[model samples]
Target: MIRIALKMLVGDRPKYIGMILGVMFSSFVITQQSSIFTGIMTRTFGFINDSPLPDVWVMDPKVQYIDDIKPLQDTQLLRVRGVDGVEWATPLYKGLLKARLSNGVFQNCNVIGLDDASLVGGPGNMIKGKLEDLRRADGVIVDIVGAQGRLAKILPDGSRQTLDIGDTLELNDRRAIVVGIASISRTFQSQPVIYTTYSRAMNFAPRERKLLSFVLVKAKPGVAISDLARNIQSQTGLKAVTAEEFKHMTVMYFLKYTGIPINFGIGVLLGFLVGTAIVGQIFHNFTLDNLRYFGALKAMGASNGTLLRMIIVQAIVVGLIGYGIGVGAASMFYHVSKKSELAFRMPAELLIVSATAVTVICVIAAIFSIRKVFKLEPAIVFKS
Candidate 1:
């Protein structure tokens, strides 16, 4: 019975292909859009992800996210250190500073000032030069992406040159030498990242009363990280959260306050609707055309239950084929786009979601066909 049903479905080349393409289109759009959205949201907390050494991040109560600079007073650092269960606390200065390129062009840079003593919250990977090189006079480390991009020097001939060690940039008119090059995650702002010591960053920053941006803390051995974070907030009247908690907070803030989610959501919804329309209409028409055959089977003692199973089998075959092709294409697209600035991440969980969407679309398309088959009349075959 199943073999006969599949032969009936495959005998019509155009309709078979159409049904597959419908589901494929939906799977592709849903997978592609969702991956891009997830990648972008992940970048919002790129700084926290890169600074893996710090277990807790302490900031001003009003600071909503990493980019929100509600600068804390310099004394806030000492206050956080005074909390019990803290192995150590280090001050970090994060702010935008204007840089005067060697070519005389002015560009803004995301300046990260690590603790002068501990150098906590520095770049996780160094492509060239040592992390200790920041100790050199007027030294700064530039991220590799920025070095090859915005921070790169432009030639008089209209070409650009990648920044390298021993290159110099002027920040706030203070000379900053490129003593190291580090690999850092690209931030949400997409600004060139510059790493310098806390005290040096203070000089580069325009004079402000509160120079401290955050306090990076390490918990004592065997201490509970979450509990220590809570203690820090209570003792200092500041906001403190574990690293993972801070990351979740940042991603959630963007989701709630930004239009990013809505934009991608519309794309997925359109894909589902368009797929349903195409597959539902064509599959129904195909079933109507084949009604005489179903009627003949009924006349020959085939029950409605058997006819129902046959329709489901046909739907499953088309659904699986379409889904496999669509997801394969999406994965290929991601690999090609990775070489460029495109942000795309498709995890296993995302694949499962895409599969579920395809399954639902296929089920919706089959519902109409199933109804027609169940109502088929055995006498109709004799008339035709």
Candidate 2:
């Protein structure tokens, strides 16, 4: 009985292929679009992730996200450092400043300032020079992406010349020499990233009373991170969050305030609808075309449960094949887009989500065929 059912499913090549394509397209769109969305959301807190040395981030109470820098007074650092369970605390200055490229072109850049003594929060991947190079007079480090792309000098021939070590940039009339090239994660805004000392960044930034952007703290041995965060907040009257909490805050802010979720959601929903319409309709017709065979089995004393199992087996086979191919294609797309700045990340959980989605599409398709099979009468086997 099962062999006959399997043969019936594969006997019609056109309908079988049509059902597979429908589910394949659905899974591909859902997985691909969701991955891009997750990649972009991950970048919103990329700076926080890059500086993994910090256990908690201290900032002004009103700061909503990583990019939403609410400057803290210089005194705030001392106040946070005074909190219990703090092994060490460092000031981090992060802000956007206009950079006058060596070519005299002006571009907006994300300027990060690390502690002078510890050089904490500096980029991990130093491509050209040492991280300590920032200690040099008027020295700074440029992210490789910025050096090769945005901050690169535009030549007269319409090509870009990558900025090398010792290239000079003018920030707020302050001369900053690129002493090192570091590779860092891409920023949310896709701007050039420049790293300098706390004092130099203050100079580059527009004159303001509050220069500290955040306080990066390291908890002492055996101290509870969450407790330390609460203690810091209570003592300093500022907002303190662990790295993971801050990342969640940033992601939530974007999801609540931005259109990113809605946009990608539309693509996924469309895929679901397309899969339902095509697969459901074709599978139903295929079942109807085989009504005579089902009725013959019913007359032979085959239970309805047995016939229902046959439909389920067919759906499972098609779903697995379609889903396997769809996810494979998406993985290929991810690799191809890696070089082109197309943000794509496929974590293990994403694969599970895609599988569930494909399963739902298959179940819905099978339901239509199931209803038709269950309603058939064995008398139909003798007609025509």
- Which model scores highest in TM-score? 2
TM-scores for candidates 1 onward, in order: 0.97, 0.98
Determine the C-alpha RMSD for candidate 1 after optimal superposition of all C-alphas: 1.3
Lowest lDDT 10-residue stretch of candidate 2? 1-10
Superposition TM-score, candidate 2 onto the true structure: 0.98
State the lDDT of candidate 1 residue by residue for 1-384, as single tens digits.
999999999998899999999988889989999999888888899999999998999999988889999998999999998999999999999999999998898999999999988889999799999889999999999999889999999989989999999999999999999999999877798889999999999999999999899999999999999999989988899999999999998998999999999999999899889988988888898899889998999899999899988889989998899889989888999988987777788989999999999999889888999888887778887793
RMSD of each: 1.3, 1.0
Q: Which segments of candidate 1 are over 4 A away from where they belong? A: none
